[model samples]
Target: MLKFNHLFNTLVLLFPIFTYASFNVGFKQINLDKVGSRPLNIAVWYPAKNSGETIAISDNTVFYGSRVIPNGKPLLSNNKYPLIVFSHGYGGSWRNLSWLAYELTGQGYIVVAPNHPGTTILNRDIKQSVQLWQRPRDLSRTIDAISIDEDLASYIDMNKISAIGYSLGGWTVIALAGGRFNTALFKQDCMTHSNLKACELVSDLGLDNPELNNSMKDPRIKAFITLDSGLARGFTPQSLKNMDIPSLVIGAGIDVGDMAVELESGYLQQFLTKSLSTYIVIPDAMHFSFMQVCKVGAVDLLNKESEGEGIICQDGGTRERTEIHRELSYLITGFLSKIFLNTAD
Candidate 1:
């Protein structure tokens, strides 16, 4: 529902009142290099022994002051905690999901989020967006890097790696978990539903790449969680049926107006026969509501200066973003905990 501001490279740095949460957030960054692959900027968040200092975290478009213990001692869980990787949507930075990372780490999970080379906020090429297979490969490489990185490997239980993706990221995790995409499926939908936003995007961008059918399945990822999953038209019943891991699909109610609910989450819930998938449609939520909550006054400022770029800042009709985030974090933690720790509420 919102367009990314390409002209402005940055926004005014601001600090809003940050409430102290139940767990202290810690931060770390590392460079990931794979043979024949571009180096990636990876960010990590884990539970820390102390409440850290407030520092500016930039996402190209804006700077957020967050309280984080930089390089602080990670709170030991005795047993290796499960690893959760986060993937952001097209034209988004890894920090877009920082709220979720903080929540996950608080719940005793080590979180890794990497900025995908071409599709991130730093580079906004439509061609890179269509190269859908690369997204999952980016995640696989993160997994590879984590396995060998001495600092990360010791604290993470790589055996229980899971992923949480939003928008195109959802497609990435599905592909990583064995779902295949048939470009023809989307093409057919384009012919019948040309007025839909996704169909219009496919037509405008000419995204008929042959690599859409390739599978980027990574056996290490045991489960996936998706939100307002974009480009799911590429999936057919057979392709979705190939998935064997558990999945949680969260859809925005506002997307039902655009058919994304039906094409993506609903379809997966109805037809992904080989796995148990849980689907939840948040009533009145918008497509961008899945992203992190904006700081106080941030939405109004973006609207006044960025011309409705604040659309991403808005949430479901009058719903407090704080409440939404709290509910979602609880749901994600519970779902992942049940899977990885065998804990049930």
Candidate 2:
């Protein structure tokens, strides 16, 4: 009998220790030599009881003493823990939002965060990256290799899995949840819709892109969720025909960039076969609010490409925003619990 406190108390716990089990746990890289050109990087945060686990916590402490803070790990995989892959926004890497990774780990789930090829600041030239629409392909491939051959199988419960992506990662998750993305599907309209005409029509959106083959048909992923990842490219009614899994689509009140559209979530609802898919829009928050990269004082989340891009001044009014994130996490954890625990009631 799970009481209401088990759910509501998540937001208010005085001596809350998010422990080291959810701390910085990094896995080895995957080589895609046979399937692709170069090997890819995937940042992992495994779930474990935050109490006492003799595991290595990453301390790549580089950025502004931020990474210096140590040990508050993911929840325990005492039995078989479910896997949840997290996708980052455009131009960001796995190290950027370790906070989200750690928090999710505390909630009794294994989290996988992968750094998309060209989008990372490590190689700023987005044009050359194979991981654009290939992000989902990358996810599907990595997932296959991990489940089939990697040591990850010992730790991960591949049968019970979901995905949560932010911004560009949101779009990637959308594609993975069964939205179709084809490049030729929009090649004619893309030429006019995009301003960088001669600059090579690069779509952060993944619809109709040739990169999306049967890669999204991964059987292990049971559920899907996306945050601030409304489809940027176009999608047809038939494009989303394969979306049958339970889903959650989360968006922020304010659009930090021209990244997410207002009605895409609603659009997806129309196409989904399952009635369980839910949509949530957190009020008074921005896109970067979901990511650990942006902060109130020292850090700013507004992208230069955005009209909504501006410094979110924090003069002690950020508590509301924090509350919102905590609320969102609670909702996500609950939704995931329903799926992994098989508690439809």
Candidate 3:
């Protein structure tokens, strides 16, 4: 019996162990030709079964990439995961928020992000970028495309959809949540505060078009979160007061140029009276803190490419960017759990 027991123990030790709570991330890219005037390139991240080769996503010399299983099969289960649509900041691409996407997927949520035409780093079309209204439309169309995607739709819970954005992307999600834009108000403010960062892009944003005042809200998005949104001053107080969805507005405490918290995130928090709004300020974080982690010597490399691009790696306080991301992840996950799971911590 002792020999039999020893053999059994050896067998058990040789067998691979698996944790039920842990999940591998899956990634894929697809293009939708009908999304707008240009084809929209989208990146999707989701909980995947441990069955494929792990690879680095969006890896570059300057930024560290997240590991994911390319085209890995979705976890085998009847459960449909919550969907989170991410909108990247101006001049950013779908990979900009990939860190957060991987985190959310690990927590059992599916994330989709689109590289906005003209505005994304991959494709910068001055004419297409100037059409500000098209930004929100890009997200709305992305949601539509995902909803009909046979492979992804089966794993997504459409009813539990949420939107998250950073910088100008934040403004895009806000518009998705029913906030109306007041072009005249924005232009007048720009005239007064000419030094404001958003004002510098007045011509590019096409603020003169009265049609921009029309509502671009998409009812499919149940909730939203914004990080240091730009062009927020253009949203009318009445429109913000009328939005009834739940929202979380996070601002970086460090002021960088005209993109101050007061003019953007603070403005949103102040006027979102009717929504179940929660506001937070990360004291150690800067606007670029929301982006992916930078590689060693990345600052110098970026500076070499462009005169002031190195600021992307700079932060406000002594804490490292990864630390800031951990705090943000905690706050964001906690808030989302309350809304999606209806549980309090």
Best by TM-score: 3
Instruction: Tell how far residue 303 is off in model 2, in angstroms.
Output: 11
Pairs with backbone N, CA or C atoms under 3 Å apart (clashes), candidate 3:
none
Q: Estimate each model's TM-score.
A: 0.85, 0.71, 0.91
Query: Quick one: best lDDT, which candidate?
Result: 3
- Which 10-residue window in model 1 sums to the lowest lDDT? 8-17
Instruction: Encode model 1's per-residue lDDT on 1-345: one tens digit a residue.
Output: 111122211220121112223556678897876454466788988777875564545433433435678877777656776788888887788877887887777777788888877678787666555566788888988888777776667877778899999887887788888888787888887787665666656633345777767778899988899987877767778868777778888888775356557666676776775347767777767887767667777777788887978777877678787776665775677667667755221
lDDT of 3 by residue, 1-345 (tens): 011134433443343321124578999887999554678888999889898689998789999998999998988655678899999988899888899999888888889999988888867788888888998999998999999887788888888888999998999999998999998999888887777788888777676778789999999888999988988888999999999889988898898777888767888888886349877777768899999999999999999999999999999999999998876776676667668765221
Determine which window of 10 residues in candidate 3 has minimal summed lDDT. Answer: 1-10
The lDDT for every candidate, in the order shown, is 0.73, 0.58, 0.84
Per-residue lDDT of 20-84 in model 2, one digit per residue for the tens?
23433433444555355545677666643334434333333222112311233333345666788
State residue 257's C-alpha deviation in candidate 3, in Å. 1.5
Per-residue lDDT for 47 in model 2? 44
